[model samples]
Target: MSRNLRTALIFGGFISLIGAAFYPIYFRPLTRLEEYKKEQAINRAGIVQEDVQPPGLKVWSDPFGRK
Candidate 1:
């Protein structure tokens, strides 16, 4: 192979390998954490009679209104 082609292939291969190694260790954990949070909220709602809202699901009628 030519020098430039070999260099490009090596660089591309290295980036692919790094992404493959990182996805499970980094991205998978974050995904599982989100799932766990949802499960916890479901359990909390089941245990309580009142409805439970997840962290980001709040609605406000007035944006600037005081609480």
Candidate 2:
């Protein structure tokens, strides 16, 4: 391929990689803020006991001491 075409392809590929990396870490979380908030609230409240427990564990508390 021509040098200009190859350079364009490389630039496009770099942009695509950056976009893919940002989508999950930044854009997707922004779009799903409400869902993430609700999920976090449930976990904080220990609504699903099994999720907070492992074998032989009877109670769970926030290690950070946050209410």
Candidate 3:
């Protein structure tokens, strides 16, 4: 490829990297705990329900399933 084409490709790639990184660093809700919670709640309404343990699942504390 030509020098100008290579330079353009590198510049465009750099710009793309910067743009991709900006959203998570500056515009994403991951900057704070409250923001993350609010963002998660906005899209996932019923995913954070209560956790219940069944009677048969009581043996989950053991990794090897020993009695």
Candidate 4:
């Protein structure tokens, strides 16, 4: 009922709410990183094509053969 008590209660409640929201959005992914990696690996295994190579820049050479 007192002003100081009310302020403390409000501050505590705000902190608790922030922590609850962050647990799922931030903490959960970090804790499950390995599990997520495994799941992604399984999902991608069937999608990869062995014959197709990923795109990248090719080697460049000068026609004059400058030293």
- The models' CA-based lDDT, in order, is 0.69, 0.77, 0.66, 0.71
Whole-structure CA lDDT of model 3:
0.66
Error of 2 at 7 (Å): 0.4
lDDT of 4: 0.71
For TM-score, the strongest prediction is: 2
Measured against the true structure, the TM-scores of the candidates, in listed sequence, are 0.45, 0.57, 0.41, 0.52
The predicted structure with the larger TM-score, 2 or 3, is 2
* Cα error, candidate 4, residue 43 (Å): 8.4
Please provide, for model 1 over 1-67, each residue's C-alpha lDDT reduced to its tens digit, 9 standing for 90 to 100: 9999999999999999999999986787566876755665676664533344455765423322367
- Model 3 TM-score, 2 decimals: 0.41
Query: Which tens-of-lDDT digit does each residue in 1-67 have in candidate 4?
Result: 9999999999999999999999987787678877766765686675645335456744433322456
State the lDDT at 10 in candidate 2.
100
* Residue 57, candidate 2: C-alpha displacement in angstroms: 33
Clashing pairs in 1: none
Error of 1 at 2 (Å): 1.5
Q: Candidate 3: minimum summed lDDT over ten consecutive residues — where?
A: 57-66
RMSD per model, one decimal: 10.5, 5.9, 9.7, 12.8
Error of 2 at 17 (Å): 0.3
Q: How many pairs collide in each candidate, listed in order?
A: 0, 0, 0, 0
